[model samples]
Target: MVQHIRLVGIEASDKQALGYTELAHGIPHIEGEFGDVLRRSHAELIGLCAFIFRRQTPLTTEWLRQADNLLDRKLDELQRLPASHPLDQTGVILPGGNRSSYPLRWAELLGEILHPLLYRYRSELLQAPIEPYFGSYR
Candidate 1:
């Protein structure tokens, strides 16, 4: 599973600086690696969104619709599984024998952080003309 890192405000600034700092600090080619990490983090969020709303007929925002479309296209490339894939096996064994699948566990973990992150950064996240924000990712 990919670990998602949140880069809000000052943290984002710090990461940007760290990505560009010279190699004398012992880190090599950090900017490209940082960009890749950021992209994977964003993809995780997009996947969580896709998993949560896969059954919904329509999403409330255009950005969400676009994300869903992207996820759909990406998923289509994979071959169908006749049975549950190994990653789909139960991962979280809760108390009293309750269990959650790997994907569900991932979604739950992401939801815990993402909901609050979105709320805390609502002004920036919910600004008008959201399509451009999604487009920038492309």
Candidate 2:
């Protein structure tokens, strides 16, 4: 995913890279092939955000707030899943036998990177131009 993002000349943060790596590794326990699908989907979103950030436009606080709200909803949904669900499983066995919630943690980390940019971009990101590189998951 970092390589994909770098193809567009954007250097992803260490947190973003680590989060995605953890997400990819953690997802298989829940849904096998689906993990790859999510990894690709998230990479697209991450690339898009990087592209938008690279544009350096001044964004409105309201837009940022809306973005954050959307991410919050996503986080809430992930957290609300039943413990037995594969999506909720982190595959990490702790010292006390507790499984880690790394998937949710990764999503939260992604939100951290995106939410702040809401107030930073002045114009809506024009995806058409960068669609070739950061468009739908391949």
Candidate 3:
């Protein structure tokens, strides 16, 4: 079964979308139907966000749990099956699960520290006219 994860964020304005190109020339626009690679990146980003945000405050524990389960399940599924799973067939690259373990930990730690700081330091100018801060993890 294919499960889709929703990315929680406001849409970018036409102007806002332009900045994405400076870095993500290879990444297609984060809209419409995507191929496998883009979808996989989106899923990873969503999981990372859930892990980081659930650390404190009104934590979304259920979402985090589901993400964790999905991570584990996907890893196992990928190992037992071929890379030709429908999701995999589309362009979604499976993060080679083991090789990336440490980076994910580092991201969690950084998120724990930074997410709060971002909220604290945000100004009317900084906070207003703000785009959803998808950190540079493309």
lDDT by candidate, in order shown:
0.31, 0.37, 0.31
- lDDT string for model 3 (76-116, tens) is 54466544333443345456632222112222333333323
List residue ranges in candidate 1 displaced over 4 A.
1-59, 79-86, 89-121, 124-138
- Alpha-carbon RMSD, candidate 1: 15.4
Model 1 per-residue lDDT tens digits across residues 1-138? 222234332233311111111112212122465434434344222222222222222222433555466446545333342214443434545454645333333233343333333322222321111122223331
Model 2 TM-score relative to the real fold: 0.25
User: Candidate 1, which ten residues in sequence have the lowest lDDT sum?
Assistant: 14-23
**Once model 2 is optimally superposed onto the true structure by TM-score, how far is the C-alpha of residue 75 displaced, in angstroms?**
8.1
On lDDT, the candidate that comes out on top is 2
Q: Lowest-scoring 10 consecutive residues by lDDT in candidate 3? A: 14-23
Pairs of colliding residues, candidate 3: 36-90, 36-91, 36-92, 37-91, 37-92
- The candidate, 2 or 3, that scores higher on lDDT is 2
Q: What is the lDDT of residue 107 in candidate 1?
A: 35
The lDDT, on a scale of 0 to 1, for candidate 3 is 0.31
